[model samples]
Structures are given as C-alpha cells and as structure tokens.
Target chain A: MADITKSRTDTPTLWVERVHPAVWALGLVMLFMPAFANGFWLFQVFGWTFILGMIALSLMFLAGYGGMVSLIQMTVAALGGYGVAILGPSGVAQISLGLPWWLYVPLAIAIAALFATLVGALAVRTEGIYTIMITLAMASAFFYFTRQNYGIFNGYSGFNLVVPPQLFGVDWRQPVPFYYLTLGCAALAYAAVVYVARSPFGLALQGTRDNPRRMAALGFNVTAHRIAAYTFAGAIAAVGGILLVWQNAQIAPGTAGLPAVFDILVIAVVGGLRRPSGAFVGAFIYVLLRTFSPDVLTAFGLSNERFKMLIGFGFLAMVVFSPDGVLGLWDRWRARAGRRDPLTGKERG
Target chain B: MDGTNAMTSRLGAVSTGSALELRGVTKMFGALAAISDVTLTVRPGERRAVLGSNGAGKTTLFNCVTGDFLPTSGTIRLFGEDVTTFPAHERIRRGLRRTYQISLLFTGLSVADNVYLACRGVSRGRFSLLRPRRGDPLLTRSAELVEAVRLTAARDRLVSELSYGQQRQLEIALALAGAPRFILFDEPAAGLSPTERAELVAILTGLPSHIGFIIIEHDMDVALRVAESVTMMHNGRVFKEGTPAEIETDPEVQELYLGGGHG
Candidate 1:
C-alpha cells in the first residue's frame, strides 16, 4: 500500500490491532470453562456445538464476506475427518497409517484446503444458485467416492474408536480436557474470522463481493481473492473436522452426506449469514435441539427421528422471520428501538 | 505495431514516451464489428479526449485497452510492453486503469473502504489475513483522494447512500488510487447536473499534469477543456485526430460529431 498520511486523529495508531483487552478477557473466560461444565454436558453438548460451530464459521466467512454460498463445507470437513482416520490409529484394518496426530491433523487440513481450491476454481465463475448446485454435485460425488472406495474410506462402517492421544500429560479425550481443547481451538478460529474480517485481504474480498468489476479495475485480482477465500474456508472447516473426529472417535461417508451439508447451512443461516459469531450462536441453538429433542419427542409419543422434523420447523420459522439471521434481527430491532422509547410507547427520535 | 505511425502525430502536453499504443485492434461480436482495425497512441501525462457518438466504438476501444474485453486481432502496448493478452487486473497492475460509463462501486462498503481497497489492490499487504483495515497507509492515500474528489464528508458513508454525483466522484477517486500511468474514463459526466459536471471537471483539471488520462465524453465543451488533444471516433475507426481547438473548428468534425453531441 502507498505510504500516504491521513489525519492523525482519524487513523488508529495501535499496531497490534487483533488483540484487544476484551479478547484477552474472553480468552481467560474460555480458559477456565472446564470448571463450570460437567463431563456429560461438556463433551456431548457444548463441545460438539463448538466443533460444529467452527465448521459453520467457515461457511459464514465465505457467505458473509465473499457472497459465496458453498454447500461443500461439510464435504471438506468429512475430508479432514477421513484424513485423521486414514493417517492415524483407528480400528480400520490395513487403512490407518498410525502417523502422529500432529502429522495427520495438518495433512487432513491440507487435503481439505486442496479440495476447496479445486472446487473454488471450478465454481467461482458461477454465482448464486449455480454455485450452490455445482458444489452440491461435487459433494455428492465425493460422498459416493468415499463410500464405494473401501480401500481408503472403509466402506459403510468407517474407522471407529479413533481417539485423541494424550499430549502434555493430559488425556485429551477426557471430558473437561477435551472441552477446553475444543473451546481453545474454537476461540482461535473465532478470533481468526474476526481478524480476517478486519484485515486488508478481507476488506478487498468484501469489495470483490460488492463489485468484482470495480475491484479488478482497481488492480485487485477478484478471482484470486475468491479462490483464496475458499481455501481459507476449507482450512477452517478442516480444523472443525479434526476436532469432530477427535470428539466422535470415528469417521464415515455419512459425515459428508447431503443432509449434513445442509445442516451446516441451516446452522450458519439461523445464527446470522452476516457475522462470524452468529455461527456459534446458531450452532448452540441447533445442538440444544439435538440434545433435548429426544426427550421432547418421547413426551409427545414421537420417534427420536422426529427431532429433526421439529428442528426443521424451527429452522423454517427462523428463515421466514429473520432471513439475515439473529444479527439482522438485532439490527432491525435496534433501529426500531432508536425511534421508540424502550419503556414507554412514545417516539424518541 | 510500429510506434512511428500517424497515431502519435499530434504532440500533446506532457510528451514523455508513449504510455499506450494500440495497433490494428479489432473486436467482433458475431457479425457485429465493435472495433475494426483502429490504432491510437497515448503519451505519458497527457490528457486526450475521445469524442464519438453512441455507436462509435468508444467503450469497445477502452475495453480492449483496459483488457475488459480482448481484441480479436491487435497489439496493445502499455509503457512499451505488449499487453494485448493481459487480464484487466494485470493491465491495472501495469499502471492502466478505467471507469465504467455507469458507476460501479463497492456499494456494501464505506467510501473510505472503496478507495482504500483500490490503493491496497496493487501492494503486497492486501493479502494479510490479520491486519487492521483502519490505520492502513493506503487509507491515508484514500483520505487524500477523498479530499481531492471533495468527498471528505462522505468518506465514512456507504457507497449506496451517496448521491449520483458523489458516486461519480468516488468512481474517479478509485481510479486515482492506483496512481496509474494511464487512466481511461468512459463518460465521467454522463449523469450529473450542470453544477456537478462543473465540479467533476474541476476535479479532473486539478489533477497533476504528470497523470495521463483518456476521457470519452459526449459533453464536448467539458471534454475539450480537460483534454489537450482529441481523437474523434466514428464506427470503430479514428475519423480524425488533432488538438481540441483544431477539432472544434473543423467542419468535417462538426458535421460528424459536435453537431449531435448533446443526445
């Protein structure tokens, strides 16, 4: 960038812009979360929410920042899950390479990122529904490829009991420890999304989203930015995938199924399509239904599978009421609040 | 492909080496010939206006030069480099920029961000995934450009919220961000009031003499005032080329272009 000078009053002089004091406070709170969450709720509920939310964050980043609605995020995550499965210790005979988790995790992320780049190069030219359809087609092909090719993906029954190894004298799979691990990673991914949103690359990407012709005319490579955004989104999804495998202790073809792919879309949209933090909020709501819906279904003399139906109803309501998701609702409500008094029904502004 | 052709015959203001030279550039859409065997040259830091009616291939010429559309058969040289095959972004990186006849902007972002992205587009720092968009040195350049375009008050506002005149000013500011060796403006005064057009003209005139420009405008008076030389185009060919004064007085040019310039 050119080294021109604007007003000193307008420009923020802070060099370390990513780490605000509040972020440190959030990190500190997250660091000590294990003290509050019991083992069952910690690993089975919140931990899974964080893991899925991280993956949804990748979609939110692409959809919100790049104006790209990719339906292949779960496919990318499944690729990462398979990476950990094939490359690490699992009960899949003749499949697991028994590599170190560190080695396998990075390898998984690389595979996912590579897949995303290829998909992006092929799909970036098409916009809106076409992009969604193309990515969906690719995702279906991948699912079939994994299912049919048992030599690597292990057919219908995927590698199971694939656990995280003890590192730094802590059993990583322990409920509290795993929850903390998931929280720490989730926080990092969240911070990264926020950071990237404020970065030069992110701004240029948003500019490309708004108007590619203008961005290209201004010397920014619009296609390159779009491709790079997908690659970045893939890496973030890969992280969620690794954590997901670590949490579930397995990997399978259904991981990247059509329903799973759209599940992420719902999670992202329900939270907010325009903000990163929305992913987490949406994931929490979705996971709550997953956790408690079985009991509710039983109380109503319905099958456990009906939980998804109930969730779908809620999802429909969310889409209809707040299409931009919760953040947009908040924005609308704030605007309304600014015009009317909060306690009394009188015009304020 | 020779630079010694009649394209550069008129020595305009700021005569450094040729900034852009097009030879035998032709573009066709099916049976329609948008540009046909047209050649032109632009010197560094010179203001040259393109005067033509609606179907005179003005936009097509600018598109081929800026790489928005590749010419079917041609050689476009930018700063002595053969750039006919270059992409739009690559051409921009090579110090060539242009504006759309209709304003195209990053409507989702602030005016400051729009200009800042333009400044940051060329530099290596645009890829940083963690840096702050605020406090960017490019933002300082953006601020300067905002002031130059008389958009300081609208700097923090969204592009969608700005009036049409403000949007046009922002369009010019975005082009200026790259500090291009050559800029091609397609109808800078297309949708502005008389007062706004005067302001737009003033902004273009206030630019440093070292900045080269190729402006295409139907407003002959404003185009002639900003430009040192004029290239009158007709049906995908250069009808005439001369200094603004010479073209204004030429009876042939009056019959072909200036007589119906308003519509």
Candidate 2:
C-alpha cells in the first residue's frame, strides 16, 4: 500500500519530494561541524553567513515566487537593526535612551514592518525597470537619510546597542549560543517562507505575478496582493535585522548603504532565486569567500585587495553561464544524472 | 444536455436574475467610439457568442464588462447586484471570471501551479495567508480541472515552454480553475490548429451547466458549434441577435460580413 501510494504520487508529476538526500547530508554535516571547526572561525564566518542568508532568502521569496525584484531589502534589515538598537536597554546616547530588550524588540519589528509596507506600496505601483528604479531610489534615499540624520540615527557613526537579552541565563554573545540562535532563526525563517510559498496566499501572489489581469478577473486585487507580499517579505527581512544588531552590538548608516544593498541582491541572485534553500547555499559560499579570500589570496602570493576583483569576475561568470544561479544548475545536473534513491527505488531528487 | 441545461432565448435573463447585465453601454477612445449604446445580458448557464469583424466593438464590449474600462454610459450588474462602480478584482470575486485573446499565464511557474493559483482565487478569498496551497482540497480540484483540459501531460512544464495550443488549453484551464459560474473567453480559438480548435469546442460545449460563458470569436463555425445564441456587433451597437442559421442567412449580415453575395 505504501509503495502504491508512493508511485501514485510520483508518476507523471513534478511535485517536490521531501528534503533531497543532498540537503539531508548537508544538515548532517552541520550537526557534526563543532567537532573540527574553531569557535572564532565558525562564529564570525558561518554565523554572519546564515544571518545574511536569511535576509537574502526572504528577498528570494518575493522575487522568485512573487515576481517582484526589490532592492530595498538591506534598508529593511537596517531598520530592524536600528529598531533593536534604539529600543533596547542601552543604546548609543542619541538613539535609545533606555528601553528593555523585550519591549524594544517587538516595537522595532513593527516599525521595520511599517517601513517595509511603505516601500512596498510605493515600489509596487510600477513594473519591470520602473520597479527596479523605484526600489533602488528608496534604498538610496534610506542610506542617505541614515548617513545624515544625527538626532535619530546619530549621523554616520550610528549607535552601539546592548547585547540582546540573555535568555534563561545564557549569554548570546558567546560563539556557540550565537551560532545556535542564528541557526534557529534561519531554520524558522526558512520554514516560514516555504510554508507561505506553499500557502494559498503564496499561490495567489504568484498568480498575480503570472497574470495580473487574470488574477484581477478572478477577484484578486493584484496591487493589494503585491503590497501584502512586500509586507510579508519585510517582516522576514526585519527579523534578520534584529539579529544583525545582536551580532554587531551596533548599527551604522553604512549598514544600509548601496554596497550592502547590492550585496543582498548578489547573495539572492547567486544563491539561485528559484528556491528558498538557494539563499543559504549562496550565502555560505559568499561568506566563505568574503571572509577568507584575503588570506587565501595572500597565501597564493597575491595582494589581499585583489580578492574583490576575483569576486567580481566570479559573479560575472556565474551570471553569464547560469542565470538561474548555482542551486538551479545543481538541480539541472541532478536531473540529467538519472540518479534514483535506494530507499524508494523510484525517481526522487 | 439536460432539461436544466436547455437553452432559454429570453431577451433579458434578468427575470431569472442575470449573472451579468450591460445596459446602454457606450465607450469612446478619444474622438472615436469603439462601442456605442450596447446592451448585453449574460444569463446563468447561457453560452453566448459575441461575433464581429476586425474593427468591430467585440474587445471593447469585453473591456467594459471586465472593468478594464468603465463604459461612458451603462450599468453592469452581476447576479442582480449592481456592480458598475466595482473594479476588475471585485467583479471577479463576484463570480465573473475571464480569459484573454492572448494567453496570459504565469509563464515562470509550473502548469499545475498556474491552475492551482486560479482555483484558489475561486474557492477562497484573496486574503487567505495561513492556509498552505499543497494538499488543499481546492487545489486538488484545480489539478482535476488540469486533467479535464487534457493538460495533465504537461502539468509540470513552465507555461512559457508549452506550445501555443497547449498555452491556450492552459489558459482555459486557468479560467475554469476557479469553477466560476460565469467565464469570458476572448477569442479562444485565435491561434489554435484545426484539431486543437475542435478540442476547445468540445471542452466549451461539455462544460457543466452550473457554469456560464460568453465567448468572442472570429471563427464563425466554432462559434456556431458552441454558442446557443449569437450577438453580432458592428459599429459599436449590437447589429443583430439570433441563432447561427439566422445570422448566416441574414442579407445585412451577409453583405457587411460574408461579402456582397451569398456563398
């Protein structure tokens, strides 16, 4: 009966099977990572990668599934970071006078969400190149506003925030705690995105992307759906920001600047925009390269600064050869390889 | 096909409660009136064909009904509810669904996903965020409709990759996915081959009685095969209304549309 059920579901359909073996194997690698990796390396590189991956993953949900390419994800993250920093118990003199972390956290998330809503509303009014320009303009405006505002943002210096509240007497700044916290957030964010993508609203959002006119004819307000998608995307991105403040113990205008904004786009595009998992994969690769490239280049008898050139060339090559990004290419290769699972003895990814 | 499905040629289906009504509808693009003072009634289970030539107001009439453009003068009611002031999406929610002359589909998504999306639009409200799409009963219904349209073979293919005919089939599949009481087909057979066209005809003719449709077509034979009543539009107004045989034999229709002499 089980076999019959498996074949019945599998035959003549591309319904995504449960987590691929490759993903499972990767998860197992993560479980065993502490055995060999040093705390410092893991804390700085892997931790940052996962957080950035979460943010990029959120953007991927909007772009791939919702057919909206937003350039303001970094700005949203900055808002979240700023939210926590300014609202938490101790902030750089200008931002947070004194607010408990618990009260500050929710307030910051809400503010970030509201900020995202405004951006989504304005940006969604246009399509294609116009949308890109609008979002870019919004991001640029946010960057400048943060850079120049001394009263609320403390000018270019920004703010040094309190450590996130220690829960159950466990300090989150320690490497293991931070790593676990980041992993937990990433996992939750990933599951949420997948759940939403597979949800009725997600389907409708995609439908709006596919044919706004048809969706409208079917009683869907296309603009409203797009805005709602943006708001959802904002909430996810904002969570990453809260974590960002937790990690850096600070917030600055540079965090929301064009470079950071562009980096988020790079992470999402390089990760493979089609699936949520692509963001993590892309982030892992990006963080590894960005963190270690200087040392790796020096070891190879090159100037450390040359690493940026290499990264640029790599991005160019990836875009030219694989527009769908690495995960998409990997999926294509897997399909071509004709591999079958041992457990099921049927076609599976 | 049955007593319930039998054709009722009443001039106005409003007495039984119209699914849609367009009265004294007039539309102008700048100085040009694409349509003028037109009235149309789409009844429950009514299969209507709006027939016209290249410059005739066929698309214009459609635009007005779907709220793509508000008529200069007219009232559109759905199921006895006044809906002239409603926007396109509100009209859809009110049980009026439609397709386009061009197959407008989410080209990046799987065919199953496209239909599933449409079905969700019909079976649920637009704001349902908590309910997941996979394994949902209504989504299953969408998959069933995909099979009904004979698109099961290409269900997983991205809509962009499908052949033109398959895209049209998918388009109709999307329209039917919502299980709407009323559907508008704008030139459904525009680019289909003979076999595909016949298949479309069969699909349209075989739709369940609870559903209603208004079709716009240039192919007179296909229209004659499916539509219970024909509405001929020329110079914006509905020039004539009758069965297929009556329009084909009308001297005015023959002179203006079928050429100067009888075939």
Candidate 3:
C-alpha cells in the first residue's frame, strides 16, 4: 500500500543506495585530485569550473524546474561580487567600506537576492520569450550601469586585489584550499537544488510551469511562486559570484557583461538543464575546451582567436544532435545498450 | 433603529445566505455579451444543474463565478462575502472550487504528485523547502484523494498515461481537495464512457450534504439524476428554472431545449 502511494518519478530513497557507483568514483577522484594534479589544474581549471557551475546550476534550477529561462543569473552573481568588493576592504579604498568578512558576505547575498526578487516580479508578469527578453534587458542595463557609475561601482577600472580573507591561519586563496572551498560550495549548491526539486515548493513550481491556470485553481499563487523561485535561484548565483570575485582577485563590469551572461546559459544548455549534475558536467567541458582550445588551435596553425568559433560550433553540435544536452546523449546511449525484455531478461528485437 | 435592523440582517446573511449568489453578472467580449444580466442563487447544500446548449453561456457563467474571467459588471457573493474582484486562488482559498471543462492537469507529474500538489496548494507551508516525511498528513490526504478518485492502481503513472475517463476523475479529485463549501463542475461528464459516467454520477451524489455544487453537463441522464433543481439557459439568458420533473415536463423547455434533441 505504501509503495502504491509513492510516485516512481520522485520517490526519495536512501542516499547511499541511490547514488550510482560511477558517481562515487567521480566523487573520490574530485576529492583526491590535489594529490595528482598541479596548482594550475587545481586552481585555474577546477576552481573556475566550480564557480561557473554554481551559477549555471542556478540557471538550470529556474529553467528546468520553473520553466523560466532567465539571463539575469550572471548579473546577479556579478552584483554579489560587487557587493563584496564594495563592502569589504579592497584596492579601491575610495569605494570599499572595509567591513568585516562575516558582515559583507550575507549583505552581498541579500542584496543580490533582493534584486533577483524584484526582477522576478517584473519578469514573471510576462512569459516565454518575454521573460528572456526582460531578464536580458535588465542584465544589459546592469552591465552599463556598473561600467558608467563611478560613485558606488568605481567605473570601468573596477576594484582589484579583492582577495578572500585568511581565516584560521590558512591562506584560503592557495590553489589547493581554493579548489576545496569552491568544490564544497558547488557540491552544496548542487545538493540544495536536487533536494528542493522534490520539495512541495519545487513540485508546485513544476505544476505552475505545466499549467498556471490549473495551479491557480488548485489554490496556488502562481506569480508568488514564480517570484520566490527567482529569489532562491538568485541566492545560489550570488554565492557563485562572491567566490568568483575571490578567484579572480578582482571585481569588474566585464565579469557580468553580455558575453559572460550568454556563456552561463550556454554552459547550462550544453550540460543539460534537466538535472543539477549537468551544470558541473557542462562547466567541466567548457573549462576544458576554453583552457586547451587556444593551444590546439595554435598547434593546428590556426589563429588562437578562433577558439570562440570552436566553442560556438561545439555548442551548435550539442544543440542540434542532443538538444537535451550531453546528458540526453548519454541517456539515449545507455537505453540502447541496456535494452531487454523485463520479464524474460533477454535482449529484445 | 435602522442600524439595528441592518446588523440583524447582516448576521442573518452569515447564517442563512445562499452558498453562491450572482446579481446582474454581465461578461462581454468586444461587442458580444457572452452572458448578460445573469442573476443566480443557490441555497446551502443545494444540488443544481445548469443546462444549456452550445453558445448558451454555461461555461462563461462558470468562469465568472470562479473568477477565471471577472464579470464585466456585477456582484458575486460566496457564502455571503462579496468576491467579485477576488483572484481565482483567493476565491479557491475561500472554500470555492472548480474543475475545467477541458482537462487541465499536469501531464509530466505522476498521479500521486498531481494530487499532492492540489492538497498542498490549499494547505499551509506551500513554499516549504523540506520534503514530506513518511506518513505526512498531507501526503496521507493526497493518497486518500487518489484512492477516492479510484486511481490508486495508477497512482505512480503520469497523467499523460491515464485514460480520458481517469483524467476526468482526477479533475474531480482536484476540485474535492481542501474543505470545499461550494463547487463548480463544468461539463464533468463530457466524453466519458457509459461506465465512467455512472461512476461520475456516484461520486457527485456521494459528496457530503453540506457541500453544494452546480454542475453543467450535456448528458441529461447524469445531470437530471444528480441535480434536484435545473436552470435552463438560452442565448446567454436564464429561460427557465424548475425542478427536474417540472423542467422535463415544461412545454416551452421541451420546444427550445429538450425537444431540440439535447436530451
């Protein structure tokens, strides 16, 4: 009777038993990566991947579960970064408030989340293409505002040397420590998204996405749910943004420019928007390509500037062949490989 | 002296007012009035049927009362509270429920998930981040609703996989979620098989006596069996109102609707 009541699609199970062996192996590899890899691989490659992955995961959370494709995630992240730089001590003494780390971190996340909630209230009023357009427009506005405003933003020559504080006699910016910090944060973000996907709020979000009118009839405030989703996604993106400022040791308008905003969307789509893990997978692929494509292009006697073209082609190929992203490709392959008659346990024709 | 009478009348309304009241409700689309000057009243626990032909504004009337589309002009009272301007969800929270004429279910979600969402919508903690524990009250309630709709065997299946009749049953279960004081069922029996229609009739007749409902059904058999009083509409206006027997026997009703082959 209990089994009959449970939904096969969303039933919660013991975490240890539900996770695949391959995932366990991957986790072990990530955990022990510092022993095998050098500082560059640990800090530059993996650190960047984790930060970008968290931001993209927020996008996946909204687009996959909420049916809202918001381009403002990257902007939210940048705002978070800017909050840290402006509130905490930085090279730009004129703008930096020189506040304590604990004080600035929560304040930064709150400001970004509040901005996202406001944007969500406006964006959810329209839907589909209009949502994308409105968020993109807001993102563009933020970019220009930061670039032009010297009062609070410090203008085009934004803050530099905005490093993470040394806590407990540990240099957090060290390559090994930074990798673990980002990996831990990214893992938490991923888990939060996965856990929330099965919560009542998440279920209702999917309901509103599928049928807003029916959801309203079911007594859900559809607009409020949608706006709340943006708030949650915004908080996740803000965390990524703070880490990103620490990673680069700087905060600039270019960090959340149009190109950067588009890159996060591309990463999410290429990874697959259906699951949280896809964000990390797509981020890893993007980081690998970005890091090596210049060398590969140069080796082939081609201009390194064509790396963007290469990435573009890769994105196009993924969309055309597996619009669900790399995960879709993997799923189809697994299905074909494992096809059999359930009753007979034999290969089916 | 006048204030005392007004207070007595207001208190009287709270105790004995109709379950649903529409006074001069009018809805217009451009130059066309879908339903104009429609006044209706249903007492507490009253089982009523709104019978109308196509374009007779039965659906339009349901939409107005449910707050799907606000009436262009007029007052709507739900259990004696003026709710003409309330949003759909607000009205639903106020013990009013409705089922769409066309099925409006979440096809991607499982049957249990669908019912769970309905149960969660009206209850508190709508935005809870925590998943329901085993044997949560709301989960148990949703399970009961699924069982009540006779979809227990298919509880794990998606709505898209359910048969047409099963989807219709799910629609009723969604409307029955929360403690509904009044329900508006729009063509609840449309496209149902004979067996399914009987099951629907049983469900409708089995509802608690305190919970009244207004049903708009094309099937006279099911409608007449379940509804004690029938309201007939023609050209968006109420042409007649009488008991099932009276409406069935009325010569004018026979010429315009029953004799026109709708029965």
Provide per-model DockQ scores. Answer: 0.52, 0.47, 0.55
User: Which candidate has the top score in lDDT?
Assistant: 3
Write model 1 residue lDDT over A241-321, tens digit each, in one string. 988988889888888889899999999999998888889989998999999999988998999899889879978998999
> What would the per-residue lDDT of candidate 1 be over residues B1-263, giving only the tens digit for each residue?
02212223433332347988889999998999998999998888889999888999999999889888899998998877788898888888766778889999988888877887888886666688766444556666778888999999887778899999899999998888755667899999998999999998898898888779999998877898899999999998999999998998898988876675633
Chain A TM-scores in order: 0.91, 0.90, 0.94
lDDT of 2 by residue, A113-186 (tens): 88888998998889888888899999999889988988787778888755778888998978888887888888
- Residue A36 in model 3: lDDT: 100
Question: What's the CA error at residue A303 for candidate 1, in Å?
Answer: 2.3
For every model shown, what is its TM-score relative to the native structure? 0.91, 0.87, 0.95
TM-score of chain B of each: 0.90, 0.90, 0.93
Ten-residue stretch with the least lDDT total in model 1 chain B: B1-10
Give candidate 3 regions above 4 Å deviation.
Answer: A1-13, A340-347, B1-16, B260-263
DockQ category of candidate 2: acceptable
With a 3 Å backbone cut-off (N, CA, C), the pairs that clash in candidate 3 are none
Top-DockQ candidate index: 3
